[model samples]
Target: MNPLKRLASQTAVYGVSSVLGRFLNYLLVPFLTYTFAPAEYGVVAEFYAYMGFLAVLLAFGLETGYFRFRAGGEWRPETVYGTVFSFLVLVNALCFLAFLLWSQPLAALLRHAEHPEYIGWCAAILALDSIGALAFARLRAEERAGYFATIKLIEIGANVGLTIFFIYVARQAHEADPGSLLGRLWDPDIGIGYVFIANLAASALKLLLLTPQFVSGLGAFDTGLFKRLIRYSLPMVVIGMAGIVNEMLDRAALKYLLPHDDATNMAQLGIYSACYKLSILMSLFIQAFRYAGEPFFFSYAKRHDAGRTYAVVLNWFVLCCVFLFLLVTLYIDVFQYFVGADYRSGLDVVPVLLLANLLLGVYVNLSIWYKLTDRTLMGAGVSLIGSAITIGLLFWWVPVHGYMGAAWAHLVCYGTMVVLSYALGRRYYPVPYDVWRVLGHIAFGIGLYLASRWLVTEQGWHWLVAGTVCMAAFLVVVGWEAWRLRRGASAIPGV
Candidate 1:
């Protein structure tokens, strides 16, 4: 089979889990928005933001490290997996112990002093998720997409189911009969805490389901291999953490930087986060692509024509992202209904955030250079610079312009990183990406979006019709370009 075809197939399988699972999980956004006030949902958002940071810390970039060494044939796959697994187990054990000893202080620091259990639940979720990170990476490396999709679906389904039971059935039952068993089991005041609990249960269940990987993949612990993996992954940890800050700092920063009271601040955050979900289509595609693309890129690295392959992949990725950007932005009138009516105030940020995520996806594709060339430190440096810009902008903007400012900050930060990464990648490990065509796609997509916005001045069916035409036109152009490229490549001797 063609390498790109194999990659597309694997991405489809991964998408079954990532895209479908996230679509299923998207249900939680509406449920949470409707069930709780924006402030309550903000608590959920903020907690998860912190989880994003902790998760990167706990995994310590070992998944990527495992992929690099294992794929490069530097060590036995089992030995690498075992080393990563054992190291995470030790780190998580220590983290859990520390959480136990200082849960109160930690809770206080997170502004959840009244509900310290939230901190503990988050710690457990992070630890379990970290331990399972290597296991999931192993499945990807082995091309066990079926098992991966199955486990991911189970976890997402369970999480959605549990959330409904807690928020709708059990909570309503308790509300109806405060003296009943359901009332004893459900606490109305727990409010958004149920979100965390549902995640905890689902993560624990996922870890349980992945026990076979833990058992079979664990081999003799080699301290030398462990040290080597750590050395390689340490910079990745920095990159991952900084990357998280770029992705999530806005959500987390809103709580502190906004001048409003805590409740008001959380309400703004909830609105921002809900609108952020409007970009789910772009995010899901990027995620699915990453899951398949990472291993695909690593494996392709050994090929004589890997650079051309990567360039093609990057072209398609940008094209897809641009299409998604138009799809969502043009039909945002309908997608806005995905969140609650109250959260709709922040709908304007959706396009900015979508474009930001698009840039981020491009940056992820460009990152192939650093990972393939073992200049992981350059990736870290790029991310740290991005993180600094993100933090500085959030502190400067969130206080003044609110979530809209944060959205722009996100766009600017990722956009800058994409440019920097491309420049550095060209200098260090050139991939001959079709730069002009990629930029043309982006410019054309934005042009169509802007045209639709200007032409479809009124809402209702007029907007929908305009959007559909714009989307179809964009697709037709892309299809034509793809055909042209294929013909052009065929004419070339070795393309």
Candidate 2:
């Protein structure tokens, strides 16, 4: 079987969990938007933004380090897994202890002084999630896509189910009968905290389910292996933290920088965040591809033709992302309904965010050079540069243009990183990526989107029709290009 086909198959299996789970989780956006005001939703969004940062710190990049060394078959798998697991346990324990001591100050800093419990809940959730990261990475390394998908779906389903029950059903029950048991369990005043509680429950459950993997991987710690893994991963921690800043700091910055009251600022953030979910189609695809691609890339790295394989993967990845970009931006009139009417004011940022995420995906594809070559310090440098740009733009733009500034910041930051990574990769470990073809596909998608924006005046069935035609044309072009690539591949002796 072709390596790319195998990867596609694995991605599909992983997507069964990622795509479906995210789609289900996506339903919560509507539910939460309808149940809570924009300010309340903003709290949920901001808390998760902080989680994105803390998660990076807790995991410390050991997941990728494990994949790199484990795939090389130099050290025992148990030793590698145990080293990462034990180290994470110690880190999280220290973190939780600090959270306990500084929970009040942390809550005050985040403006959640009224409910410091939110800080504690977030701490627990991040700790559990960080520990679970290595366990899940182990599954990926072992090629247990089925098990991985099952565990992921279970966690997502539980979180979504619990959220709905607490926010919708239980709240209504409490409103109707304050003296009842359900009412006692449902705290009407704790609006957004319920979201955190639900996540905490789900993450704890996931860790419990992965106990077998965690236990089996436990062995006597190897200090030498631990030191080596940490050395490789230390740069990744910086990369991961900087990457999160690029992806999530916008929300965090919006909370602090916008010149408005707390409620107004949160409302603005809620709108931006809900609209951002419109681009999750592309985000979800990138995540599923990452799940399958990382291990696959490492495993394939030993082959003489590995560069060609990486180039082909990058091409197809960009092609799919461009298609998703066209699909979402063209029919955004329909997808806008995913968020409530209150959040639709920020819908214009969807396309920009989609393009930004597409570029970020390409950047991820390019990043394999640094990871495979063990020049992860270069990855860290690139991410730090992107993060610096992102922060500078956010400080400059969010105060002036609001969330639109954030949208532009995302595009500029990711685009810069893509160009820089490609340049550096070419110098250090060239992958022969067809940069022109990738750019052409992106240009074609953008042209179609612009044409649709110009031609489709009405927002009714006629607009949908025009968008459909545009999407169909985009698909046709993609199919033709894919066929051409396949024929070219067949002509090669061993692709």
Candidate 3:
């Protein structure tokens, strides 16, 4: 099989679970938005955003460390797995204990003191997810995409089923008839608390499904080797923490930057979060790309012409991202139904955030340079710098401009990181990337987007016509470039 095709097959399998799973999970957004008020759903959004960051901490970047060491090839797979498994078990146990002890205080800090169970539920979810990190990492290392997909799909399916049972079927039944299914499970006083319970149940389901992988990895505990792996994975604690903080600090900041009223602030945050769901498509693509790209990068690092291959991969990434951005922006008129009517007011952030994510996807691709070169510290430095910029902008701009400021902050921060990574990459591990052609594609995409934006505003098929034209232009350019590269016509010398 062609290498790219093989990679695509793996990506599609993973995407089945990752992309479709996320899409299914996103089904909750509309469901929750309509079921609960925007402010109520906003609580779910904020808590889960924090969960995303916490999952990073609990996993501590061990997945990346797994890929690196697995590629290093100095030990048996069992030894590597054993080492990682033992350490993570100990660490996650400690974390769970800490969270259990501190859940009430943490909830108080987040101003959810009356609902301390929310913190406990999220903490449990994080711990479970962290424990499964090695199992998931093992699947990726072994290229067991099919198994990985199956496990993830099952987990997502279970979550969706339970959520529906809790939120839709149960709640509606209780409302319509007191003797219905929801009445049995419903506690009217708990209100939206069942949302967290459903999530907790689903997480425990993931733990059960992961049990086999966990057992298989622990043939014997290699204390010495475990210590070595810990040393290597420990730095990731800082890096992952910093990276997650970068992603979630905005939410933290936004809470304060907005008014003191919980209802008002959460309403705005709800809008922002729902608009963020619009960009989840981009996030899905970036995630699937990372799954495929990370292993591909490590496996092919020793290839004589890997640098050229990296350039090719990056160019293709830019092209695909631009295509996704255009498609989403153009058809957003229809996609707004994903959120509730009240939330559509924030739809303007969709385009800005999508573009920012496109830039971020590029940054993710470019960042592999540092990883492959074993200059992971460079990544830490770059992310820290980007986080600083994002935090500064969040404080400086969010209060004045509201959600729009958050959108621009994401764009500026991600854009700066992309440029910074490119600059530093050139110095340490220069690849002949096609800077001009990539920039041209971006510029062309911006122009086409602007034109479509203007032309689509009129009545009767204007959007359809404008969108079709823009899409065709994008595909034609991509096709032409693909052909040129295949023919070895180096229009941009190094490219």
Query: Highest lDDT, which number?
Result: 2
> Mind giving the per-residue lDDT tens digits that candidate 2 earns over 1-495?
678788989999998799999998999998888777888899989989998999999999999999988987888899889888888999899998899789899899888888888888999999999999899999998889999999999999999999988887788888999788887779967877899999989999999999999887686478999889999999999999999999999997798989898889999999999999999999999999999999999998888888887888888898999989988998888898888989999998999999999999999899998999999999999999999999999999999999999999999999999999999999888888888998998999999898788777644347787888888888889899999778766653465
| Model 2 TM-score, all chains together | 0.98
Q: Residue 259 error for model 2, in Å?
A: 1.9
Q: Which portions of model 1 miss their true places by more than 4 Å? A: 458-461, 488-495
Backbone clash pairs for candidate 3 read 170-182
TM-score of each: 0.97, 0.98, 0.94
Q: How well is each residue in 27-64 modelled by candidate 1, as lDDT tens digits? A: 88888887778888888888889889989999988899
Task: Give the lDDT ranking, best first.
Answer: 2, 1, 3
lDDT of each: 0.89, 0.91, 0.80
Per-residue lDDT value at 60 in model 2:
90
Q: What's the alpha carbon RMSD for model 3?
A: 2.7
**Global Cα lDDT for candidate 2:** 0.91
